[model samples]
Target: MVNSITGLISNIQRYSLHDGPGIRTTVFMMGCPLRCAWCSNPEALSIEKQLMIFDQKCTLCGECLIVEPEAISLDGGLRVDRALIKDIESLAHCCPYDVFEIIGNEMTVDELVDECMKDEPFYRNSGGGVTFCGGDPIVQADFLVEVTKSLKNRGIHVTLDTSGGLPWDQWDKLASAVDLILYDLKLHDEKRHIEYTQAGNSLIFENLDHLAKLGKEIIVRMILVPGVSDDPKDIELRCKRLRQSKANVSLIELLPYHTLGKGKYTRLGMPYPLGRNNEKDKVNVEEIIQIIESIGFKVYYRSP
Candidate 1:
């Protein structure tokens, strides 16, 4: 019956170095509750299968138009009315060239477990295991719980990368199942948090507090978006909150923002929320690191 539990996933990246402790496999689960302005994995944000068109690969073939004439057009080039398209998979299949790609895949718990187990030897040798990330793995908490349980029974380490945006009750079972948590602390101000991520931080902070009380090992990851999340005052305040909560924060990781995902938005035929000029110089990395270290927490940052 465990084989019948299916989850939508965007990708399963293997041999990841930065996701967790050792060489690990990172499962990019599909779907998220938050719509952060600087989201890099736009394809994983939605829980449904989405059509990703690579305009460059298109050869102006009218085959796709024949499949869904109303949703596709070859006027000057390739044009897709994504909202009007049905049978996305069929439309993608109609393309002779891989100009069309599907973003998500449905995977059963047993299938996912087998895929992770393929790297079990590497996990054992490197102290690395499977790290569940996404649009936020908590979005598919039930499926994750079963998968993690199967993996745990096999002695594999599991990590949950999350924004903690959902209510505790929604993902408490999932939180208990993972060996470690890679928690994201994006913005502290509730109003500003909602403005940037389209989600409130109250529940996120509450869940962090709960994780702390449960003695869950947490590594706080903060993406240092230049004009948005780089405010020293906000960073300091966030650290103060983390310190006050006595969250078992292993360390703080400062991730610099990049425009790598901008192209993804284009492929999905969706406007990148952050404009083309959104890439600004990151705040002084040393200063940001010092700020976190000053609060009695170790810091890790990889320059972009």
Candidate 2:
């Protein structure tokens, strides 16, 4: 009976199909432990509220400059020096045209449920419910558990889309709250996992094993990143682990490599670390499907 609980949310996307079984309301929470190079939602990586400067949306009216002219400058185009600002939160109100938009929202569990209840009709018709997603929603496990408990009490199907990088104790708490788990397996080798995702896979594998033993309905998602996670040996090793776990895997999804998040770096004034290798990292969907099917698991493809 947890009544008062609040979580930092990045976005609450409605009618999302690829996240789960049906049309789902994917609640994207802020913060993540691992920093994956190919993260699609870069804004959600940090726990704090961030400001995104969409230059395309700017009219160069210099309304934001009035708030902090020293922090922001207009040369050829508008440029915001985020480093110079002490209190960046105040700048979000300075923009009238939404060129500088804050990307996080703090909402209580009751408030969030009220928002989700608006789409209950859609959920019932499409066999879709609510999905708790990232930047690794498991980072806010306690908040998620409470919110999910409330959702389930209302007879809503809840799904957790996670990277399985959290503690086993947290996973134990979530096992009863969620209806399904959409787990991500990036790399099989521990060293390689650290090299790319900036985290180890030991806890991930351990938690997966524990969840499988509990017989939770799970869907494993593996993103095919060329020269990084797309290695045949890595894929085979991951599949072997899944087979050994004996978890009820509804599907094994192979998401192809894409440059969808490349522009996000420019928006955040950060360098794109993956370079221009997205084109080369692309995988053949049909071939991957066949390979995964041969491993005695149902395979699905989402092209890059």
Candidate 3:
């Protein structure tokens, strides 16, 4: 008998030019518990598997036929006719620019290692490996444990991109599993945090404190979303906390709010969270950067 390494995977982003360190494979896991208004990957939010069809990207090739007849014609353009999905999946395997995609699938740890191993040479030469990004990897504690363990044993560096809003015990279990952490700090005030991201900052701040105390190599991130999250006061609040913490703070990336996920809302039958926010002044980035840097923290315009 053999013990298998199984993990929940929503998307396999190979050759991701941007993330951290170097060229890496980004494994987006499903099921995030955060409702951040500026979330970019809403499709990766649910724990359940879903078929994401981009009408703009689709060629109307009539592919993706499910075994059940009722599963067809999700938006009148999939055109998945009599062709069996087995063949269609193989035929349109990762179509150019992702015409259609099945978000989230369960795979074993061994299977995940096998998949990531394809970039072993790149990892070795560039000092890059797997980055566990998800709705939030911390949400799937056990699977994250198994996957990171396997990757580490195989000499792969693992980075956890999180919101730092997990159970303290879970954080304790996951602390040593990965090589680095990319934690997100959205809003400052507890009330504002809940109103914007729908999560309390108490746990997030607690996790941040614990990570700092553990001497974890952490990179703090703040998404600068125009007038809302990019306000001078909000920026100063998070920056002050970072400076006061034991963690080595770096430059925060001001990811100017964009409508990247606008279409996803309609596809998911949900409304886009884009609300009233002032047009981000182009000078805001420099202003925010200067403020953070003035505190003696090496602040940058992008991800630390």
Ranking by lDDT: 1, 2, 3
Clashing pairs in 2: none
lDDT by residue for model 3 (1-304), tens = 2437566787888887556778799999887778888787887787876555555776644444333344456466564433334433443464555765666688877788789989989988888888988888887877778778878889998888888887778757676788888888888888988988888888887777788788878777778776567777777888788766777444455555666677786665466776754344443777788887877667656432
Greater-lDDT candidate between 1 and 3? 1
lDDT of 2 by residue, 171-250 (tens): 57876679999999999999989988999999988888888888899999999887778877778889888888888898
- CA lDDT scores, all candidates in order: 0.91, 0.85, 0.73
TM-score of each: 0.97, 0.94, 0.82
Q: Report the number of the highest-TM-score candidate.
A: 1
Tell me the alpha-carbon RMSD of every candidate. Answer: 1.2, 1.9, 4.9
Worst 10 residues of 1 by lDDT: 274-283
Estimate, for each residue in 94-188, the C-alpha lDDT of model 1 and write its tens digit.
88999989988899999999999999999999999999999899999999999999999999999999999899999999999999999999998
- Candidate 1: C-alpha RMSD after superposition: 1.2
User: What local lDDT does model 1 show for residue 225?
Assistant: 87
